[model samples]
Target: MTISPIAYDVQVHEYSIRVAGPDDLDSARAVMLDTVYRDFGTGYVPRWHGDIIDLHSAYVAPVRHALLVAVDERDEVVATGALDSRGPAHPPNPRWLAERYPSGETAQLRRIYVRSEHRRRGLARRMVAALLDFVAADGGYRCVYLHTDPAVPGAEDFWRSQGVAVCDEREESGQRVVHFEIPMPVTSSPVVVM
Candidate 1:
């Protein structure tokens, strides 16, 4: 199946949803780290030197996962989302699993970030739609779920606009988390590749 690039704003652009390869890992990690620091502010500093690199490595190394990046004309990774095929979900903790999803055929969306300068241009929404389209084409995913912290503000509304419904909420390790899911279509359709 092929996917034709959907036209967003003139300044907003998306790349073909490519399967993130080894060469793209560094760029993906860079985007993720930059986004974390920007979003969390100084609080992310302590963990910055220790865990960031390894976290990115895990996302890139997993063979069963699919990572998509959205870049502007300048070619920077403006946003990224990963779909974990094998699972109860990525990050697979029992607590996270029980509090959120009920354990089923699900694909997890993670590290969905867009640079602050690029917000409101609809790039994040496009990246998500592309990811969903990709999942629909691949077949067998019953749903796609993700978690976001309420502290981010507007995060919940954005997901809601994208058809994700909040299923659960909890506070763990001092972070407030909200789980959102969108049911996947049962039948696969051929995507219009760009």
Candidate 2:
């Protein structure tokens, strides 16, 4: 039997996702930490802690970036994701990417993490769909890309199932990194209801 995703304590059978508020930082942080420790063990803390501590500027407030959090039963953030503009202001790779994206915007999909307790319950799919819809609504994105570890068991399979194509896969530093991209569907004008 397929289990449905859980929401807040009041409605255990429902799950709600929304743009995060300042109050949700703690829960969001917990989910991120859980995901990192789950994947990298305890070794990434020192290397990534400083970056993690500064998530606010790029994800939280006073910035145009979009950060979404999914709330499960007990109102805990079971999943989280962010969209950082891959534009002139923040280019992930200026030398190569600038030539490729000369006229369109590319969004960098970041921090898509789902808690172990909520796995296989369709939360990941929903979260991705929501992020895509958000981008489509803004009418400013041509494609979205993300970097992930393909060797991590079901990671590649899951991303492939989401219609993501393997754009680049290479070894970086001491570890392997896989890059995937999905072209966004062009959004049409909204239907006007009389």
Candidate 3:
């Protein structure tokens, strides 16, 4: 999938991180496919493009889940990140995560993908912030969980920098995946001074 020539020269500072509605399927899919094939090619759990990365269930969830996209100045989705109920749903479930919690409205930090050209510009961090804020606002979600491979360059390090504690690590389907958990802060009454 080729981006338009007009997409060039757009700065990250000009982008907006917003919630993805049903209308964003095309743009989101492009980002998801482009990022996975380029970044996780040959190493991201073989034969996953259709069943997981490009799955249709992304748009089927109830009120608690959200898919976020960072649109560049040209209104093209340059990156995407999603958070959904930690259960049988889009992109399949990481079973190990269920064993850790076994209950509660836990959120899986699924599908955080940024186009190669737009990386290293703090986009990923912003996407994460948006997802966290989204979940925090949609009450009942207790924490956030995610899994990534340390073997992938900077994958674990970047996630760790976000304050997600290493919860568990195990070999799954012959590949090593590290699981992380971040306890969502309870939203209390605001503090104000008059």
**112-172 in candidate 1: lDDT tens per residue?**
7777776787767767766676567656566777767656757878877766655444544
Candidate numbers, best lDDT first, in rank order:
3, 2, 1
Best-to-worst TM-score order: 2, 3, 1
In candidate 1 the C-alpha lDDT for residue 188 amounts to 54
Q: Give candidate 1 regions above 4 Å deviation.
A: 1-17, 42-63, 86-104, 168-175, 189-194
TM-scores, all candidates, are 0.69, 0.75, 0.74
Pick the lDDT winner: 3
* Global lDDT scores for all candidate models: 0.60, 0.64, 0.65
TM-score of 3: 0.74
Comparing 2 with 3 on lDDT, the higher-scoring candidate is 3
Per-residue C-alpha lDDT of model 2 across residues 19-44, encoded as one tens digit per residue? 77788887887787877778646534
How much is 119 displaced in model 1, in angstroms? 1.2
Error of 1 at 167 (Å): 4.0
Which residue pairs in candidate 2 have backbone atoms (N, alpha carbon, C) closer than 3 angstroms, thus clashing? 7-14, 7-72, 7-73
C-alpha RMSD for every candidate:
5.5, 7.4, 8.4
For model 1, give the 10-residue run with minimal summed lDDT.
3-12
